[model samples]
Every structure is written in C-alpha cells, then in structure tokens.
Target chain A: MAETAHAASREHFGSTSRRDSWWLAPGLVAAGLLLLGGYATWAALQGTHFEFGRYLSPLYSPKIAAPWWPLSPALLILIPPLLFRSTCYYYRKAYYRAFFLDPVACAVGELNRGKYTGETGFPFVLQNLHRFAFYLAFLWLFFLWHDVWDAFWFDGRFGVGLGTLVILASTGTLTLYTFSCHSFRHLVGGKLDCFSCTAAARGRHGAWLGVSALNEHHMGFAWISLVSVCFADFYVRLLSMGVFHDVRLL
Target chain B: MPEAVLHVYRGDASGGGLKEYRVPLEEGMVVLDAIHHIQGHQAPDLAVRWNCKAAKCGSCSAEVNGKPKLLCKTRMDALPPGQPVVVQPLKAFPIVKDLVTDVQWNYEVNKRIPPFTPKPNAEWRWKQEDVDRVQEFRKCIECFLCQDVCHVLRSHGRTDAFAGPRFLVRVAGLEMHPMDALNRTKFLKEDAGIGLCNITKCCTEVCPEDITITDNAIIPLKERVVDDHYDPVRMLVRLVTGKKKGE
Candidate 1:
C-alpha cells in the first residue's frame, strides 16, 4: 500500500486505535451485498427456471421475447434496477466502505490511493445519472406491480398462493426502496424553496415530507428489497423446477 | 457510591499515555462530571475544555470508550459497568495539552466557506417548511464531534482537501436556504473537497444534535455538485437552454 504521512505518525491500512468491533459492520456489509449480488447474477444467467404455472421470477418480469434476443429475458429487465441500485445514495456508502475499503471504517486506516476524486470523475461520476436511473426504476415499478397482479392468476382464475405473497413482498419492498430514493425525494420536495408560496409547492411539500419519512429508512428498505427480490425469483425458480410445490392459499 | 476508573490521556502533542484515575461516581453523573472529580481531587491541572455542561455547547468533545462523544452528555451508567472508560483527545486534531486539542483548524475551515448571501431583490417571505429544512443544519453547535468522527480527517488526514462533515452541514444550510443566492458548487468541488467524503454516515451517528449529515446535508450538496460539474445530460440541457444551474 502507498503511504500517506500524517502529523501524528500515520500507520498502514486497516490500522486503528479503536477498541470496538469496528471491522464487523463493513465486513458484514461486504459479505451481504456480495452474496445477494452473486445470487441475483447466477439466477439471471439461468433463464430456464424463471417461470412457473402462474408466477414469474422478478428477475424475468414483463417477459421479453424476440427472435434476435436469444439471451435470458432476465438480462433485459435487470439493467434498470441494477443501475438504480448501484447508483443509490445508501448503497454507494455501503459498497464504497465495504468494497473500496475507503478508510475501512471511521477512523480506521485505508489504502493510500494517493489522490481520491470520489464521485467527481470517470466511472464514479456516472453516479450523477442516478436521477435518470430513478426515472427508469420508477417506470419499472409499474411492471413489477403488474407482475404481482399476475402472480394471483392460477388456471386462468384469480386466486392467491404462496408465490403471490412472495412476489407481493418483493414488489412492496421495492416500492419502498424506489419511493424512498434521495433523487426522488429531491425531485418531489427538496427543490422547492417555498412550500406555501404556491398550491403546487404545498402539494410537493407534503410529498417531500412523506418521502423524507421513508428516506430515513432507505438503507433498511434497500437491503430488504434486495433480499425479497432475490427470494421472489428463487421461490419462482424452485416452483418452475418442480423442486418446491407452490401451496394455494386462497 | 461506586468508584469508576477513568483512563484519561495525559501530556501533549509530543507524546502521551493513559493515566489511571479512580473517581467516585454519583447518581445521574456524566463522564465530564467524573473528569471534574479528577480535577477537584487528584490532578488539579487535568486539562479538559467544557461549557454549558449540557450537550448543547458542543464543548468537551473526546473519545469515550473508543467512540467520539460529548463528555458532558455521555452518562456514566451508559458505559459498560466494570471496564475502565478510556477518555482520549479528539485524534483528528493536533493535541494541545490533555483532552484539549487545537480545534482552531475547524474554525479556519469555517472561514474558507462563503457565508449566506441573499439573492438580489430577494423577498424574505419563505414558509415554515423552508425554515424547518434549514433549521436542522442550524442545530450544529460547532461541536467538532462530527469532524472528529470523519475518517477523511481522522484517519486519512485529508485536512488539506476535505472540509469534513461539520462544514458540509454548514454549506448545506446555506445552499438549501430559499432566499440565499451564492453558488458554492465550484468551491465544494475544489477547496472544500466534498467528493472525498464516501458518505459513511459516521458523522451522523456521532452527532449529538442528530443532524442527518449524510442523507440530508451531504448527499444533497453532492447532487448539486453533480449538476454543475459531473452530469453530462444536465450540462447539455444547460448549454442548449442557456439556463443557469440549480434554477
């Protein structure tokens, strides 16, 4: 590791005077994100078991089919959500600290990359497109909600099942995640300087307040939504493979 | 009365080590109270700075039990019952004597930021919502606890570039103000080094005032910075429409 000198005699990477379990947070965050990401990637690659009788994997929602596009349908649908998540404000913090080891944990030593530009240039600068991705993610939410609605159709009859509940949980958590986005919060309410000046502004202020409330727990929603989406796909995959029987709930 | 062991750091910038002092704990007492007991009885010159013994003054910022906290606010009972509570100077700044470090660096950084400049022909008729938004940032008592907890300053020693979380909160207050006009995005990008922050939320965790430093303050400011400097689409729109940024 490259060395950066300090007035107090700086130490090497990962060095810290902290006595607490400082490494636990970043370690778990890295492992969790990697594990979830790995599962999603693997599931996306396997196009065969993405659908059951009524339920469709969230990874392959809106089931795209074209003669030219022979690849997994999941590949087409996952990009927007992946971009939205990869650029998310909360996820950026998690992955940056966990994967980049940028100061590892607070007050803990980090690798000396000499000049750290953060999100101002190159690939990192692409994070600025988060707002654009937010639009796409917001649009995709409609598709996800549609899939949740379709999950109830069994033998051309509307009925609830375990798969319906799983898909519902996925869509619900994802809705929370998308609505609680910082960009969405800014677009809805944060931009307005005077809320009471105009009727529209007042309406936006109410939206901002609601978004702010949800934004407070954006990190929690992010994790839960990630897990739920993966679980939704995993359950549907199992059902499609006839490994796990889907129980009719209604 | 239970006696608590206080492991307080002694000496100055040259070097120092933890000195064990046993203080008699009192009912509803704080870590600052224990330090005061040490001053009153054992060591008369145990240098520790404090004011408004309430958590409001932002004084007496130190690392208690390996966490950056206000000594005046840390309850004695809140710490682990048996273990010695270690009190160290804010490791980010240059040590002055004991627990007092040269926090003047923060004040210097405070000077570099442009003050709130009201917009030209501005009507100061903002609603309570605007007030509530900026009011969260105004709650900062200049504690420097957020500064101490920030790893860019604390560990990486990027005081030369990064302006830490405290000043970022300051910038957020000014930038978010409806009537305010001055654009500091260039300054935020260059001198203040807003990009260096990875948004760990450590500053938010350690803040006694509970200001949402990362999510509310820093991230919004980062978005503004992105608008002016990084985003191509926004830049193209500005270029074509001849619209000023943040309009």
Candidate 2:
C-alpha cells in the first residue's frame, strides 16, 4: 500500500489565504445586512412616518389596524418579508459565513468548535419557516400592488408624483426578487419528472425555465430589492415628516 | 511552436510551491495532457493521479486557474493564451504529492451512511416519475469536487460534523427512493449535520454532472430534517402517539 509513504508525504499549506481581496465581498455583505436590519428595525418601531399624502411605506403596507392598534404597524407586516429573507437560500449562505463564520469563504479556515449543530436545532431550525413564509410573501405582493395603485391618487385625484414613482420602482424590484427566489423556482416546476407528457406540464416547464433565468440573478435581485425597499420606506417617511417635498409629475 | 506555461504545484505535505514548466501546446491539448508531457520529458518524478483520461472517471479532478475542474476536461484553448495556467491540488483535502490529495476522508464518510434498505417482500414497482429525482442524484461519480467546494468541509474543517454536499446527495437518493423504507432524518439532523449547510449552491455551481445539489437535494433534505425535529404539530403528534411520521 502506498498509504504509509503517502501519509508521510502529507503537507499543509499554512492558512489558505487568497492574494486577492477576498474579505471585501463578505465584509460588504455584513455591512449591508447590518445597515438594512438596523434601519428596518428603527423604522418599524417608530410606527409613524409610514404614510404620506398617498404613499405608504413598503414596511407597513396593507396597514391592518387603526393608528391606536398598540402593536407597531411594521411588526404586523414584517412577518412575511422577515421570514422570506431569513430563510432565503442565498441570504442564509451570506449570513452563515459573514456572521456565523462558517468558514468565512471558500477554502478559508473557519471557527474550529469541534462540533457543529446545523439548522436542525433551535433558532436556526426556524429557517425552515422559509417555505411557509414564501406563501405569505407571495400573498403580500398583492398588497404592494394595491399600494402602488393608491400611490397614483393624490388628494383623491388621479395624478402621478415622485412618491408614486418610488413606490412603483420598489414594487417592481420586489416583484423580481419574489419571482427569482430559489423556493419559488422549485415550487413552479422543479419537482416535475415529465415536462412534455402533458399540455399543462409543458406550460409549467416553460414557467420553470423563466424562473430559472431569474434565479441566475437571484443575488443581484436580493441586493437591489433590499435597497429599493429601504428607499421606498425612507421616501414615504421623509415625505410624511415634511423633510422632502413630493414633486408633482402630472 | 505555440507553448503554454504550466505553473504546476510541486511539493509534499511538509511544504511546497508552484514549479513552472513550458509545454508545447497542440491543437486539442488539455491541462492533463500538458501535465503528462511534463511527467514524461521534463520532471520524471512529477506526481499526478489520473485514469481513463476522460471526464467520467473523476480521477483527474484538480483546480485549474483557481477553479475546481477535472483536469482532462479543461482544454488549453478554453483558458486565455499567454498566461500561466495555475494547477493545484484541491484545497479541501490534504496534499500527498504534486496534484494528488488524500481524499480518503470522503470514503470514510460514505461508509457511515446506511445503505439502501427496501421493504421486505414489497412489490418492486415504481413509475418513472417517482424515481426521477433520485435518478438525478444517482448520476454522481463520487468526484468529491462538491466536497472540495463546500465551505462547511473545505473551509470550516467540519468533516466530523458535516457530510458535505456529495453525501447529502447520496442520502437524498436513499431517502427519496419510493421503495426504500429507512428514515435517515435523525442521522441527517445529528450525525451528518445537515443544518450546517446554508445552501450556498456553490456545490451545484461547480458540479460537472449538473446535479442541482442545493435546490433539489439539499433543500428538500433540510425540509425533512425540519419536519422531523422542529415542526410543532409534528412534535405534538409524536408526543401523543409515541411514534414518528416515518414509522
């Protein structure tokens, strides 16, 4: 057996560090997620500035209760998006490496805790909620569209404004994000065995391909939609606080 | 004659670095062919493991230009001309010599998994659709590239905990088999450490067989783990009946 000689020949390269700037990507992801989480938390807690003349913050859209509902309006509507992002296949990797340091990057050494309990345990296991949360997120899109419809009406008259455009852009990007989800792709037709056996199955296959195309850009959509949601909320909040003027485009 | 600079990694476990060799390039030469030329003429002692010289055997797996690929499949033309094609052993495994790494750990992990267990005296009948997903996983050639790219094993050194993407695909095939009656959810949750994978899809990206490791296999297996361990309704049912769903 060459095992003995091979065992003797084993060599270790000291800490496989890349020459290029590998830390920059994960560092950016960490900063971005942190900024988004902090901003969303602060905005959600305030409960005010989520609405203006016609615009509603993406964070508190489909305002389910009265202003005196006691609970933060953001909390009421945060469940769907929170579950979507938390259980997101892509975001899971991002945070797992960025925050958990589960081998920070490819080939880079990670925290040697000797034992690892994956998502099967407590809070991490909650990530399984993503599939269920996907249903909620799919349903929440309608409310965002409804808000977009309301955005066009200023003072009850049909007119376009800066808030309308912002809300529209936000909804558009979120639509891309929703459709591009890995879960959504699997749900569409990833489980099918025969794509050409039936007429409806063929159509489903086509839809799956379409979703697969978008899934290729799932990461890009994730970041863009995240930024767009924050911008949408900030736009509505600033307008509500009289910090920014709503330019009439009609 | 057109030539390419091959910066092949040369050294044993104690220490090593890249040793450059200029090989005369042919019209259809691959990186493996260049290595063979170097082994034949220049460095007779240069060590590289290969068999079949085709993409199927999975023996010539290495990192070409810092990407995990089968050496026989990566053509010289595919890489940019006038640049040194850096070839190295897989970073995830321990280097034995030159481009050969000790991939025995993967075989060890494979042994821990329970083999396919079919029901006794059960009629063996399944529609093509039923086994189609499992068939996708059956295409694995044990290349270990998935294990190489996996951060849980390659980066985090969680070989003890995580089974990497390759075994997860194997478990997926067993668990999803319509005729197989064994429930590996417990093993998946605890022993294999399925939760450690955050579904980066890097394994899928690097897979030459086009197996959808993350979406089709790993994610669905993760769901089974969650249903068995975490679901409140399932937990309550298990408490009341003293029996699991698979039972």
- Output the number of the DockQ-best candidate: 1
Q: Given the true complex, what DockQ would model 2 score?
A: 0.24
- Kindly report which residue stretches of model 2 are placed more than 4 angstroms away from their true locations once superposed: A1-24, A31-48, A62-80, A99-101, A111-125, A129-146, A152-165, A168-221, A241-250, B13-17, B77-83, B118-128, B237-243
For model 2, name the residue pairs that clash: A10-B13, A11-B13, A11-B14, A118-B195, A118-B196, A119-B195
Which candidate comes out best when scored by lDDT? Answer: 1
Docking class of 1: acceptable
Backbone clash total, candidate 1: 0
User: Model 2, range A1-250, lDDT digits (tens) per residue?
Assistant: 0111122122232245343455787799999999988998999999788999778999998888667668787887897898898888889988986887664665555665654556656888788767677778889999999999999997779999988999999999989989988767766765454455578867887897889789878888888988999999999999898997999999
Model 1: chain B TM-score relative to the native chain B = 0.98
In the range B1-247, model 1's lDDT, one tens digit per residue, is 6899989999887898999999998999999999999999999999999999999998899999778999999999998889899998888888889999888777778888999899898786877777899999999999898888887777667788888899999999998888888888888998888877878788999999999899989988887887788778889999999999776
Error of 1 at A149 (Å): 2.3
- What class would a CAPRI assessor give candidate 2's docking? acceptable
lDDT of 2 by residue, B1-247 (tens): 9889989999988889999999999999999999999999999999888998878888988888766889998899998777888898888888989999999888878888989999799777766655666899989978788888786666556676788899999999998777777889889887888888877677997788899898779887776775677667668888999996554
Put down candidate 1 lDDT per residue, A7-108, tens digits, no spaces: 444657877656789999999999999899999999998878888987888888878876688877778889999999999998888988899887578767
